[model samples]
Target: MNRKRCLILGASGGIGEAVVHRVIEDGYAAAVQYFTNEDKIRTIQQGIPEDQWAGSFQADLSTKEGLQAFFRVLPPEWDAVVFAGGHMYSGLFQDMKEEDMDALYYVHVKSLWMTARHVLPYMIQQKQGNIAVVSSIFGTEGASMEVAYSSVKGAQNTFVKGLAQELAPSHIRVNAVAPGLIQTKMNGHLTLEDLQALENDIPMGRAGTPEEVADAVGFLLSRSSRYVTGQILHVNGGWC
Candidate 1:
């Protein structure tokens, strides 16, 4: 008998890596995708046993050609997908470079929409599938210095809700995990003082962990969440 398989986009990242492990533990073979982090994805692939390793894919989602090639190579029968790819920019909206803005839109908005277009057919045919995107709290409560990031994440949230409604009739579920301040390398730019200040604002007095976020993704992919759809499950520790 064959087990279900899930594709983990941005599997090299902190939350993505945790989700990869979580999906495997939940009895699904896992395929990992990464853009430039070959070493990191390889390390994650190695950690999983061969039976649960569904191979790795490298795709630069910022380009159309890359997206085309990625879909061409993806295995045809993925049981679920977790869009955890992220790109961050922090600056005044006016000062934001066009290239940075383009990258954010491509990664957060365009690629996500395209991934759904590519996979929804298989899911619709099977009459069951799961999609969970890694969104941010800033998506709902806009951030001051991260206007572009917040805008794209807001688009992500909207996409989740809209697509969920459309796919519900097909028995496919779509949801998002909007994380607060997670302790990922993506936040390496923050100094200890910066982290402390941010933590102080959270009611929980701390940031969330990647594993905690992954657990939520796992539940969304599981039969446990059969009735849960079109929801943005906030993993923020009462920070919002």
Candidate 2:
């Protein structure tokens, strides 16, 4: 490929969609992973120049079969992989269910580990690769009603740090972008009063854009951040 190439997980989501554009804008061809929204993936894929469209894969990511299917479909080599996929649970801890928690674990933590494992052989052989995870500020500071979600985000943050160091000698860079609060469908369930209240708490008094987070991610995946790794770059309007 003339430019760098990448695979981004969760292209159907708001942040994922924005990152796809940003990666392409920075001159990278891409492959996208979608869970149940094949239509959206097709739309995004169609928008890219045919030459820059790598391919698309669909998988649950919360189950072994799905992860295997997804990984099996990946090209033998790519310049980067962005774990831009996640789920959120925003209710009191008492109401959380066992199955839901398991889903959170698999999607946020397990999938990342498995992804790294799947790509390690290729990246190590190439002696270089970039992994940028989409994390959230909730991971840094606990949120009152989102204990489980925050916990998962915290796990992602810690995992990025550990993995970066573990693979640094091989020249593979790992980093994460923790969006403070973003205006996305994930937060669409929030009541107007709740969103406004949350925004008021942010120092900048606004929710961030997915494009902003994507830009930070683009930096991590580019030569610009060659010397940077194992860090959580916050994109949350200074909320945390």
Candidate 3:
């Protein structure tokens, strides 16, 4: 008997790492993908037992060829896919250059589209699989000074919704998790005051944890959410 397998992109990030642990704990094999974090990737691999079907691959998500190459290295069959790779660029819309927009589009929108194009065929052929993409609250309601980042994420949010409807007949469910103000390396640039100000804005009065978002991913990928698809689960501690 072979174990079910999952492919996690951006496995070195805070939420991605938590999702990896959740999937493994749920008794599924995982193929972790990371870029520019060899040490962290190695540590994560060591934590998994050798007998489990686990492996790591490195790929830049800014190009189609890179995404294709990443998928080429994975197992032929995967029961689920969690796309957690994205980049954030903040600046006033007028100050944002074309290059900045291009970079965000590539990482947040194009790469995810390419990865799904590459992997969806397998899931469609099997007529059963789960696909989850990590989005952000900024996607839902545009963020100030982060116009490009918000736009790209908004596109992703729309993509998952439309894709879900199209893939439903084939039994391939597509959904997204939109996180708000999660404490991660991504937020390292923020000052202490900035953090507190953002926390105050949330109705729940604090930022969410990667583990909390990961648990949402876990639910969407499990039997519990078997009938749930084409939805955006917001894990934003009441932050709109």
Best by TM-score: 1
Rank the models by lDDT, top first. Answer: 1, 2, 3
Better of 1 and 3 by TM-score: 1
**TM-score-best of 2 and 3:** 2
2 or 3, greater by lDDT:
2
lDDT of 3 by residue, 76-145 (tens): 5677989887789877899988777877887888878877887787888989999999999999998898
lDDT per residue for candidate 1 within 1-240, as digits (tens), equals 599989889899999999999998999999988999898887887789899998999999887778789988876677899999877998789998888888889889998998888888899999999999999999999999999999999999999999999999999999999999999998999999999999999999999999999999999999999999999999999998
Q: Show the colliding residue pairs in model 2.
A: none
Give Cα distance to truth, residue 57, candidate 3, Å: 1.2
Ranking by TM-score: 1, 2, 3
**What stretches of model 1 exceed 4 Å from their correct place?**
none
The lDDT of model 3 is 0.88
Tell me which of candidates 1 and 2 scores higher on TM-score.
Answer: 1
lDDT of each: 0.92, 0.90, 0.88
Kindly state the number of residue pairs that clash in model 1: 0
TM-score quality measure for candidate 2: 0.96
Checking candidate 3 for backbone clashes, the offending pairs are none
